[model samples]
Target: MISIRKILCPVDLSKGSLLALKFANAISGRYRASLAIIHIMENPHLDIPGGETGAFSFGELVNLYKEERQEEIIDVLKQKGTHAVDYEIIFKEGVPYKEITDTARNIKADMIIMSSSTSEKSEKVAGATTERTVRFAPCPVLSIKTDHDQEKREKIEKIGDLMDMSPNVKRTILLPTDFSEHSELASNYAIAFAKEYKADLIVLHVIETIAEVSFMSSVDLPGYGTTSIYYDGLLKDAQARVKNICDKAIEQGIKAREYIIYGNPRREIIDIADKESVDLIIMGTHGRKGFSRFISGSVTEAIVRNAQCSVLSVKHPEHNFV
Candidate 1:
């Protein structure tokens, strides 16, 4: 089984950060994994007589801050820590995204436990951090948002149980692809996951929005034979994409099924998930910039918001694609 070992929680020292810390503590307790509490200070500078110094120059100052914060974090851990789990605290200075990501990678953390804040102010901060982590982090990230009210905390706990990843429940993985290299990498991960779980693999592709219907027009029906041929070729191309994905899956020794659907990609993907009764959906998000970020690659965001099942979105590293 895939085990979660070290969980990295990036803190901004906000109340929401503490909530995320609590959630991480719970998981670490359950699984007995090491928890790393990381707080990053962004470009902190102090103006001097001559000029401003780089944030990196304040190493001693940052260390002092971390030491103070670390003590407080340890106190929380002591109150909530279980007898079985072990954890440590870390404080670093750098850009929030870069430091957290680097630390996770350097330590080979199995998962990252962070929070998604809901307050208007917190949401703005979280949205950017979440986007960066989701786009670039090597491991899967779990984001939580904290409300300080006791009643709200209970509500959040209930929601967490419903969504809190349980033990070895992963059985089937749905991989929606556009047949790009990024999709292929995601497929590789899905296959690895399926093999680990002895699970079934579902490969899906949608021919929507971009799908064109072509036929010979009566105005030049006979002359447009080539156009008719091209339309047939398009369908063939779509089928080829599905076939290629299936071939890769089979090569990986995974039991594979492929689906090709027409209509809106988002709607079609969700419909397929419901119809197939899948437990999880693993798909590649193109991470197209500008409006696409808000729309989440047009179809991907739609499926995530609408689907009843769990979704894992994998994006190509900019160095690889962009």
Candidate 2:
């Protein structure tokens, strides 16, 4: 059984934090796991009951200093169905990403649920704060978008919510792969998740053709004569790899299929998720800032931002997320 003992949800109590809060609460309710709410204060000083620094500009801290509104934040969660008494409120100081990752590890959290920035400038992603936390978190990261306006939006809802709406329908899950070690690791999580839900899994491999690249912007490319040959060769290789993956799952009698397509990996992944009505997209969190970590294109980031389903980003095995 996939065991989840604790779920850590970091929120600023912003409108963006609600959808993530809903997911966290739903998952905790389903798994009967503990849930904790945390609001990180970037500045350590600023009238922190006793006094430490000049002033904290994070806004929530401002209220904590002047009005003592911590309980008020808890009340908001209470109104939305999560009992305030069921969770402990964590207040920490330092850089947002560092504090978040540190808290997850210190508490042995099974998963970190937070909202990603969906602004136009962000390439529809988790932004710097969410991305860095996912990069260093000790466990799997559930990065959600802060796009809910009225009620829960379908685009941000995943398996936790699905478990509430439909318990008998076989969920379709999409897992995009690049054949990298990180992607391989993600496949393991995907397999485990599929077994948990008894769902059909679709392994998708997208080939970024020269034509698709050119469509995104002005880029010079080789003629179809050369490009088409390279495309065919790449497709064959991807097909062989996907077949192996599907065969293994099918041999075990798990519903599995393979899809190979030539297009922008980012766009294709999102489109396929919507088209298939996927419950979740389990993929590798393989993005790095500049030349720091191994640089994979932000295809994973885009999928987290725009996919019409919740995403589970599995970090490298080197990271401790147990």
| Candidate 2: tens digits of C-alpha lDDT, residues 90-207 | 8776787888888888888888888775653532333567767777777888877656443446544443345643557768879899988888888877877787777899999988
Model 2, CA-based lDDT: 0.71
Top candidate, metric lDDT: 2
Tens-digit lDDT track for model 1 on 144-196?
A: 53542566566555534533445544456788887777677677667766765
Candidate 2 stretches with Cα past 4 Å from truth are 42-69, 76-86, 117-128, 148-161, 165-167, 210-229, 251-253, 292-296, 318-322
Best by TM-score: 2
lDDT of model 1, residue 10: 84
Query: Model 1: which ten-residue window has the lowest total lDDT?
Result: 42-51
Candidate 1 differs from the real structure by a C-alpha RMSD in angstroms, to one decimal, of 7.7
Model 1, CA-based lDDT: 0.65
Candidate 1: residue 244 Cα off by (Å): 8.4
Error of 1 at 226 (Å): 8.6
